[model samples]
Target: MAVDLEPLDQALETAHLPALSAALVHLTGETSWLRPEWRPTYTPLSRGETGVPEAEQAKMRAAAKAAITAYLTGKAPMAAIPSPEVLHQMMNFVAGADIPEGYGDFLTDELAIDGHSTKDPNWSTPELKAAARKLNVLVVGAGMSGLLAAIRLTQAGVPFEIVDKNPDVGGTWLENTYPGCRVDSSNHIYSYSFEPNHFWPQHFSTQPVLLDYFRGVAGRYDLKKKVRFETVVEEMAWDEARSVWKVRLKTPSGIEHVEANAVITAVGQLNRPRFPDIKGRESFRGPSFHSAEWRHDVDLTGKRVAVIGTGASAFQFVPEIVGKVASLSVFQRTPPWGFPVPHYHEDVPEGMNWLMEHVPFYDKWYRFWMFWMVTDGLLPMVTADPDWTGPTTAVSQLNLGFREMIAAAIAAQAPDRPDLVAKIIPTYPPGGKRALLDNGVWLDALKRDNVELVTDAISEVTASGIVTADGQARDFDVIIYGTGFHASKFLWPMKIKGRQGADLHETWAGDPRAYLGMTTPGFPNLFMIYGPNTNIVVNGSIVFFSECSVRYILGCLKLLAQTGAAAMEPKREVHDAFNIRVDEGNRLMAWGAPQVTSWYKNEAGRVTQNWPFALVDYWRATLAPDPKDFILTKSAELVE
Candidate 1:
């Protein structure tokens, strides 16, 4: 409510008026405010098609600009909440889904906006802060989720420490330095809901920009002071008797132990890189490294390179390195399905950037646009139709149409290169694997004379080169493992001992499961962010999910503080029931498609990585932790 007029004037001066007007219209829900001529001509344009011509857009922009200037000069406080009808209309416009029963909650809880009470409970309250201060919370990994947890905890006046294995923040962005390593998700929505950056250079921003953004977030919140860099959590034992967690930390100096009341494991699934167990991999004389551990020093100019595994990372880096290498051999175990994205590599236009920074609610509305675009967009395609017969092409009619669109895109991109087309089109369902974004660069790279897409199974990696199953040995100067990470392995390497000294790894037995992907039955006062079955492969941003998880964890802590409880864990029956429902839901998803093999699944063929439900479903589940679903032990009982 206390906005400076100067900032508003700067925004209004060069603001994209059409976009600004639309944002205000969406936010205020005042139809009269936007003239008929200034309104958007197209509601939902198909992919690759431009909507609303430049001439019409210019006119709208001019009108909207004038209107914003008038409103700013009048010095009106922006309405904090819209009418119920306006809210409903906004929901319909943004989500493109039927207004659900708890649509208002979805706006506040999921969106984390000003309309509702999404803020953390008053931990700053003297008694609450005193109780929380007495407790020690250890967060593992100073990544996106961990940083968020720290920020929330700091705001809540909770005492916590962060131990990250990496030297700095930005876990994935810090590690993955592979060429063309950029996010497939839209940059606008990929970030934290509360921390929107309106001036991203690229729509799908590269790793460096992302890393910088994270560092900025960490710096802004003063989170770096609380973090112990170059430290790893080796083991964590929940001392149920003492109602505390004894965490064994591995640091550069020596091993250390920290006793904490609770632990929030923000160590994400994609942190650990998984390399193929190829025979004679060690015998290779050439410099070989996983894409995550990219060797930037090694120059590939005029050198032959072999890129193994055509997954997301490989798909990105291969295109970038193809031109540099004299001959590039891409070994594909399974081809990835590329989603059509015309603006994947395009820069965020200056006009749009101005609109985002200057225009009132424009950034928020833009984020809403992005959120709605991905939410439930591909659910139908990924949801398997048992009655439908065609397995090779797609899962259903809609999915088939999607498949046709992309496949045709590939063909159109490389009409002369049929061999590349055959090798490129994935045999599995579209959403079975993480869908990649393509703007013709990947297909164009494959059509180059120096590039070869090898669909052969790698037999062995000889000192000279790699040998295929067909007994053909191809020589290369360098080998790059574009293979992904150990995603199914949740909280890996850390020997977590729960109640009765139950090893966390042994308990799961390679198939990790968590109740609502946050709490386990035995791990008292322990929470997980971006844990098992919480990975967003298709719909929504992982950052959004992390926010949800952190809030849920905070809610649990709030419950403990309010009840004077020492510790709390999910009830066994409750945890079991939640997982059972998760399993049932996953059975209907594309990841559960019998023939598909992806990182999403564990060794047991169970979907241990993905959230089968929509983002709203998860939002509702994490709104608060029910006391009935948890076994709460009072502080008095613990003392006794």
Candidate 2:
């Protein structure tokens, strides 16, 4: 087949210079593109935007085009996996910074620079296949994490069933049909590491796009057949004797009970929307609904709309509904810090998408760049310095640097409105709460003639409207609660009983702790995907965490297959020790500061929802399961 080298000229022009250069090394098997001038400038809060001059970038692009063209035209050979040292160099070159020491291999595996998902298990042996057949896993939720579990299980020749409360796949994405619900992270990295959608329209894909992506993945894996849609897991009790989970499922028809050797809870933390317990919350006779459950049927056109909370959901939806609403009164408890992302909602350039598809390693390198840029974002923002003294908005000098830079960007959003700026700026630290991606439309929406930013505490809600603490009662025809989710509730409403009739929720007592945010001490053969402390804020996407978790769960199952154990759970000492380390790490993080409050923390004031360490650390820790850290229980069948 004749190749198209002519189009490479134009496509190379739109290429991310750093990713192009790194990819050229693999495409042409040449090291010349790893030059100093080809590297990007390490700018905070920006994807790899090469600060090299246009002339230099052109030279690099020409070089990349030639290299890629050679490979396409059968003149060059794809380079084999580079050495760890070489990968470390590429990491630094692509990131435009010295990646912290001992992260070379971790980042290499995480980036999957060799085009392989590190998490996908291979139970190749007949013995392993027989072992897999013996274990039927029950996966709760057909969302991103659950679908990943289903795919991996299918790949490993393991039998499994997936159940989701929703009618289809895509957990949150399928559920949240708000006006402007979109991902805050870059879509390239936000997606599954195994399934890279080079043709993603937007940098941050909207809900429908994201849902389509997940739905496509589900179809690709033929996972929907294994799924019980519109079915909910009501109660799952562990049978200590049998070493199986007796699951009670509520289907569209009626309740049904089933048993599985293992259960992986992929029902995420943020599914349940947490409505603020204001006085007379139910008194509002107006059509009120949580942002997660957006009322698409109720028209908001030219109606007085009251949006409660200014979190990520509001940040996206308000911009969409502001112009349509007659008046938008945003009730904000604490303002979110908006990170300036010029292309947050912009579509990928046609040429860039072309490069990603045609160029050998361009997509991988580009995805790696996005992953690394926000990889250890919390290291500076969350890690409090002992010697530093700063305002409550900042805990350390590095933290202050991020806060000021983002704050300045946010302030510039409403340059003419001093009053809006005063209300928009958060008093807490930048990492204290979930930061939102803004393309300047958020401020534009807030600065609208009909939009009013209400900072005063909500006193109560009347039959028709909301009452402020300042004795101001505002009427609204529609109330949208963008108030965040019940993130602290690990697995709520559903009943999960561990060994010895121990209740999962009652055991945690509002402070959910899990080893690596997957397995707890008592829940044998029961794993969690987006479990406690697994949520990422500044670091990376939850997909990454879910991938890591699912991988870890596979490793655990592999450990069980080898040990001939009925089930295994993290040792109590190991679980407690690991959580101690996590809590200590969170304590040092900026989010752990006493003054700041957010969904990351529980009612008892413990940081229970976020991973306090770098993304790489979690990746490394979940690579394999440690048998020594687990307590293996011999099943009655195996014992006999």
Candidate 3:
């Protein structure tokens, strides 16, 4: 019932220094760094510290290999270890950060490391079986969060239906197939905790592999059976009289209506591509498209390409197309902070693969190592230091350190051209916007004779190409916009009505706020995954946030089933109070810096699309549903 230890074992045998050091700490609850005799040949600051004396390196490698071999050969059952000890290990792995009180519950519920053995507390009780049977849940979107919801519902024996506009289950990944499209998050830890893939060919997997992975997950969980592919939820109304959700769906054949006791909206933020509102956009006679809706059939060979918005997507695809295209112009509003990752495009080594296949618990331990490093390691840097005076550079001293590191990386890219560095280096805080991972590919592409970095504002688009504010009109055969998404607009273009005919859109007026990023007042029996204020900016993977949100939704469903409640909604006061806390927390985060302007905020300057707290804080808040924070209406049968 526990997470298989095979992956972790394999990681240990591979002796990947960081993974091994983290695992040793986690497994033994050790606060100190690995002993020199057992340390791997690498450290964070210095790569390939294999410069260690031959005898010493051999001794350490042999000792580490032997230690992992013992676990793989059944001498050690790591899963059999107690939970408290594991918690200790987790804390030590996170540099001795105090474990939150709700962490144990978070581990079992959100992490679900026991490979689906742990059921929602409400469904686990026999008394709720009848009520649970009556539950008909509708999950909108068959993407990552939607798949998780469907799997959990099936495990809880609840009848549910998933509707996705996409023909397949990959959602964003399925739609985005631009050249060089890939995941920014580490593939190993970016996946479902229970279903780890040790065979990721690259540390940062490409779009196709990610799509296949999601499709594979859907198949493994038997979720496709419950999914109505190419179906979109047009509108959903809360039928207060019936205490159910009346969902209007648009399928391939025709529109259909269904009634569900509960609804889970898993439509995430990244799907909607936001095209810049530029003059003469319609005048562009060339084959113009958003990067997400790439036209692969159109050949770019010897063609002049005009790419707009140098964001994450632009950073990726520019390097790929620079060599193939004849002339390339990259338009930028603001340059992003680039974090240098030397092996960003490197394939996974064979030795690492061998350890993953052969060593026990190795993959699991390595995934945990990644989780801790990315999740908590970057959090402190993003938090605002009230007394710190630096504004244009960074929000805090820790953030200044990050800024310096990224600046050095930019300098390394174009060492001779201080002009290029000045244009490329961001003036805002490091985590104010997304910090892109680079290995000089971006700068190298910009340095190409065929490539030009255009920082001027777009004056207008001509029939053949773009006209910049510098009054120069450059002609191109193609235009690609990498301007990201309408992230702050949550549940956009969907008409959702709740109690008293309260419209979801009108309620927020373009600023969406949900209680714990799951439920909103007046919307009974409705839950959201990847909702407002839940996006991670500085720390953790979006997948992790989705899991946390799903767990919270499951907890709500449990409460409704166990209590035989006709409806349950967050109290208005509670919802408002939670949002107030979110705003305050965001004020103390770099993303909320006054000079910073990004998609994370709404028109009113409210930070609507990010989680400002540490991952553990979110986990703690969503461990269980607080009955007092909700208004529950008992069912007629239960009342009788």
Candidate 4:
């Protein structure tokens, strides 16, 4: 084989040495490479820095160089796949944690260790294929989850159509086009497990790159041809007689009705932007718009701007626009907790990308390292310890450590500005709300000469300016509302009626509950993608959650096919029991604290938006649908 040894050796210089060490173990069966002194030390911030000393890193790199050369020259043979016990130990060593359980099989499939998808549908027989093909399904919102649903459905030979109000594939990525809009999660694991992109420009890619990734995936899978662009689902009702869902759609031309055997709602939790209802909000005279609906036509150069709500969106965009705006005043409802991440906005180095693109198993092992880090890495820090009678600002001893990390980051960023630091630090415990990825740029933006971080409550917005409770009025040419989304209102504004003429909205009463964040008691033959309580507070990407939820939905469909059942819904008792356990579990989570106010909780104070369990638990529950948990029935035609 023809290979350039010089470039390969050079590339190893920039490689993540621990991930490379793990990959070497998988390749050459060299357990000695994973020495105790070379193991990584766990830290949520600055994840790229494995605590392996400089001497150990150099030794690891030298060993990798020799192994790769031998393998390329046909002198060394790849090892047979390791047993479960060995695999589990290797993962624990690479992750720098002794994860109590074995998720080895899960890691193999999710990370594609063997370089192929093991999660695709297994309905291969002609009979099972026929059963799958006989069904018609409708998918709402052609986003990450919807496109994933389309791919899995197509593999099953099932007939399905996708619809989206926006004329695009990415739901959040397409809509939120504000300056510096990018995914906070690392892009390597934030992507679909089936199709990994080895060449993301940034570790956390910007909106355009992310949108292009989704759009490219949609194109590769031929998903867009099956999707009806500019179409909206207005309402859906279950037809108990036909065992179908009567879905009403409004197309670009006119309104129309369609019927489907099942429906999957992938609209997601963050689509609709929420603007605060400060008095006279509509009275702003300048060009005012929500961050989701960005207006690039209106320039901000030399213009005085008033930004409302310093949430995640503002955290990203404020830094991008602070230099251009003449004067900036930021209104903060509550400060967000952000930890310093050096590569949050940095580009993927060319040599590192070359290593991934060229090295056989290097990218997967690298991704595995990141996935393992976030899988359950931070849960302990944010978990509430009920027996602790300490400060209200922190939930547990571990949580206090995380809080101190953030405090240290703040002090390092702005040592001279004590007054600013006092206003910036959050009073609530860490993980009470969304934790942001900061590189000290957000504080740098806030400390600019023209920028003012206003902590005072807003009194009202007049035709020309905003009035604060402190009796100060600020005038500006533009107002940007970064108040975030209506996250608690899952599946909002859509009219859905289920069995017994059950209204889904009225049934929820603003407190949405589902058996497993997918199916409810009355919603037979319906599945939600990013449904109630499925959002993660301090864990990995939501894409992982979507994959788990879609797998469960498919399991439900396969169950229907095998039993010759027309419909299946979670049993009322089962649904109620599961939710009761969820509430109890959430009561021990930091996000569920009484004083913490966030989008995770509904107006009624129920934790309606977050999953209060381990990442592996969701994976296990959604692996396959249990027959005992649901009520299944045959349709009239099948009953005969």
Candidate 5:
């Protein structure tokens, strides 16, 4: 059943309305705007029709008026809202509505006035030159992050060069060109907030569209010129004698040395693919490839295919290839929680786009609604409930409810396959790991006669087939590994050196940690973007976190220019204290729970990946750099 106005009304009735009204007024400091819609009464309405009634409009208006009056007259209740369901449903309605054309243009104009635009008065060419003279910045991996750094540095008048091993600029978008590959995040939120794309063809953009967006961003900002594509930085050492980074870089042609005052490592975690080390992986004779490196030349029609690992990439690609392949063998590791997402494939109506584009305050409110729904509203569900008895595997009561909903969906799709249901049901909490969206297609694909779901461990890869631990052999013409990435490893294969020539990998010891996921103590003037513990587990855009990191990095550069500082790094004590706080915060979250074994935590049982706070909290913390947290050195001073 589709979600409609009835659920909202029932939710409101179940919730304490008077308390919610009082809380809304107190939160917004506006009593009149906190009123309910007059046309929609408190009664539940039917689906697939307009629920508002003219007859009850006056009564609803009176109720809202009374609430507003009571609140304004200082008679507001001190009690908090019993539940947020009503507000959550209201936000869903707001988001489901139309977005107007030219919405991006309007936001751009406003941002221009606020000095946040790329063409703002504060971003003059002279400022860029001044920053260049004072600070030498090194940008790692010339993908989205590197390009963005170059643009910001150029705008701020700072001199910087982008280094990347690949010959192209698109990071994951460039590498992962598999069939049916696309972005799961909405295109509106995926693109940079400062550089919004008005011409996205799909609401959920494809890989090519995203690649084009990155290319366009680079060209528009003149960042391509500063990027040294194919040049890889082998090692970066903090030179105490000169108070500069000694960068050893390798190009296809030869090696080169450069000195930089600051470094920004934006290589990101998902760049490397992690393949499972099966006993006889090397013996596969037909064809084997990771989902990231999909081979298009090998057609799937009438061909037997063995797909290993059921993760996010597999979820997207499996449905796409299920119909084409003759027989399919799916290897199961752990089942992911699937949430019903109605608009996962629905197009944005022209009227909705119009409202988003032309209607003042509409787009902002819509974005705010999304932010609340994904992050603030969903974050609470990530905690473990000590009193819940429904399932020990599920994190909380709310999460258990979610698991039931998903189970119902799976059952509806695969009525004949109770065995498959048992295999696919997750024993862990709903939000313990990444939650995938269901369009009702995956289960249908699995129910196909040609499909096989194998739960046994892969024992070996024979010359002609794969043998499971059960001693059963399955012949396949192709093998696809959707085994995911080495997420907790942070920076792998890349050797980074800091003070005393300490190797970064050796220091991390397989589990990476960073102060605020941006800096390490010994790595003076070096910053890591999208570093460990910076990943948002709840609802929020990764782009939002990236922007916050960018702001902090910019602030550091500004300080260097203002003080002629030779080097700056977070103080050892401050770094340790911040890590302690992060660990303490994680202890209360689901990732830190003893039984959970998600990639969010490392082998040492440390929650090294996810951020344990709300998006707003991180934003407030990183809005500006705190000089007190860093060890700053003047250009004239020499270190002992």
Candidate 6:
């Protein structure tokens, strides 16, 4: 049955006009919606003048109506939209129209359509399916990566089971339940592309909303049926005799063994928190806990509170608790670069949400805009500046611009506190560390009479208070450690024995390395998602990276099936060469600059955390694993 068009039209009346208009333009390459007989040109506009031609205004308007009508009536498909150049021009026209608050500009450049079609002739779908049917797969960690791996495997008709140490799903989100806990990434881009969410309440979704989304996804996909919760994989040993992974798991009742043809380690980096070892920490009687493990029972009303570490979690929680505490002291290790974000807290308007819910292409376009702004468009600003004048400040011209803007904002907010300004102002280049967003609310909270910003190092924790390095003691009833995670330690607390009894820890020597951050040379039939050097510090969504990793892993599985191979692992030479390239790339970026110190790099000063390229680069690199990169092994029977 054909759907009615009247309701959709009525919905569009109250919808985001600009977004709808852009969709119309994208559907019908007619600038005539604005100026009828006139075709658009790409000439730069002069100062104080509109570039749009006035002569063909009427014809363009008529063309726009015709185009929109065609799209609504099933006369045209979105893929049939005119040439890319013309479509872009139409998008600009739509953006210039009357639009809602958050729909300022149409950003389509950030879309992850790298011109690689899913229906490519090179994709050996049949062979891959055959390979997957013969193997049993084991996935560790029921977080975003693991859940995603299961979904992809299910779609490919592959046999797999997911396991997590936690009682339920939603890994980090399940654990970190602190006040004002939320995601810094925009919600649209933070979600999986296959399962785009249209119901995000805010641009930056809070922790509960994110956790609920993950839960809903699991339920909808029936992933919970295959997941073994509260069960930990104690150790995994490669059985050379059988050519399989013998996994030892410990449940509440007893130990169990499971054998699988392949293993995927999706254990994320942010699961473990690294607490600062303060002298006499154990002696102090005050309540102490990491921010990830927030104790809600401890009442802070009219009580002295001390927050150590100025990382992301601290930034969010400090503002929330400042008003409740009798006195608040925030200890800073190093201040983060505060980026200017205007809509961090603004609620998504009802009208916009309505449009996203009702309009056909509205949500997709919005997600595309977010993808561009937060990922691809922001990459250049993260690179180091070799020609900049100041060595102690921004690394490049673009980085300097961002620094100057942020500094001006800080000065404007804290006009009375020059001392705080000097302390908060970062000496390193912009994007040297994780960039933070503030709506002047954090600064306002700091300016309160009861709040104090402590820049000194902690000498020790006494029975009743904290002692600074200068021998000054300040009393506090509670201490919260926002010291962040054990990020550089890739897959910690897991004992993995690879080929010939090779321990994973001993192989990497406390510095984990993987080829394309997905597979290691000695770890046969083992894969990793979001592993070393795969962290998207500057330009991409973790979801995007995970999807790319899944695609590559699927490709490897397909290759094994085609060749009747029992196991596959990257060659040592391939792994080493990849790491050398990653090292060289990191050295040229701002993270390697001498004046800056960031967690992105480990103690050895090697960037074990971030991918130095644009998200698109990673997408292209991991689109499919190169056959030459791996060492294929056949079963003994086949070899004989």
- Provide the clashing-pair count of each candidate structure: 2, 1, 18, 0, 18, 13
lDDT of 6 by residue, 1-640 (tens): 4544444434543343434555555455444444322323321111112234554444434444456556667888765544555545544443332222222212222232333333121434676667667889999999889998888788777899998999888988888899988887777778987677776789788889999999999999999999999999889999987889999999878899999999998988888899887888887688988999999999989999999998889889999998899999999978887665667876665555655654456566566545545655566776775665765687777777767877887778888899888888888877778878777777887789998999989999889889999999998899989999988887787788998999998888868889989899888889999999988765347987888888888778777777787888898898999999988877667776767777888887778888887666776687677878888888643321
Model 5 Cα lDDT, one tens digit per residue, 1-640:
2212223333333222323333343334444433345212221111112243545434443454455345445566433321333333333333333223323333333223233542222434565456556777889987777777777777677778888888888888898887767776666667776676644666667788889999999888877788788898887788887888888899988999998888899988787888988888888899899998888888989999999988888888899999999999999878876666545666655434543442223344445445545665566777766565656677677766666776777677667788888888788876677777677777777888999989888898888779999999888899999998888777777778888898988998977878789998888888888998998776467877787777778877776666567778888899888889988888767767777787888888888888888766776677668888887886546322
What is the C-alpha local distance difference test score of candidate 6? 0.75
Query: Local distance difference test, per candidate?
Result: 0.79, 0.85, 0.78, 0.87, 0.70, 0.75
Output the TM-score of candidate 4. Answer: 0.97
Residues 1-640, candidate 2: write the lDDT tens digits: 7766666777877778888888877765667789987777867876456788889887877777667777888888788877777777887898888888778777667667765657879788888888988888999999999999998898888889998999889999999999988888888888987788989898888999999999999999889999999998889999998889999999999999999999999988889998988999898898999999888899999899999999989998899998888999999888888877888878788788888888777788888888877757446766777666767778898888888898898888777899999988888887788888878999999898998999999999999999999999999999999998888888888999988999999999989999999888888898999898888878488888888888889888877776788988888999999999999988888788888888899898999988888888898899898888888879543321
Query: Which candidate has the top score in lDDT?
Result: 4
**Candidate 5, poorest ten consecutive residues by summed lDDT:** 39-48
Task: Determine which window of 10 residues in candidate 4 has minimal summed lDDT.
Answer: 631-640
- Ranked by lDDT from best down, the candidates are 4, 2, 1, 3, 6, 5
- lDDT score for residue 81 of model 6: 40
Once fitted onto the true fold, the runs of candidate 2 whose alpha carbons sit more than 4 angstroms away are: 114-117, 636-640
RMSD of each: 3.2, 1.7, 3.8, 1.7, 9.0, 5.6
Report the CA-based lDDT of candidate 1 relative to the real structure.
Answer: 0.79
Over 4 Å off in model 4, which ranges? 1-3, 114-118, 636-640
Misplaced by over 4 Å in model 1 are 1-22, 26-29, 33-59, 75-80, 94-101, 110-121, 635-640
Which tens-of-lDDT digit does each residue in 212-322 have in candidate 3?
Answer: 999999998878888898888889998877998998988899999999999999999878899999999989887999998999988989999999999999999999999
Task: Give the alpha carbon lDDT tens digit for every residue of 328-380 in model 1.
Answer: 99998888888777778888766567667655677776676566557555576
Show model 3 residue runs off by greater than 4 Å.
1-14, 21-58, 71-122, 635-640
The predicted structure with the larger TM-score, 2 or 6, is 2
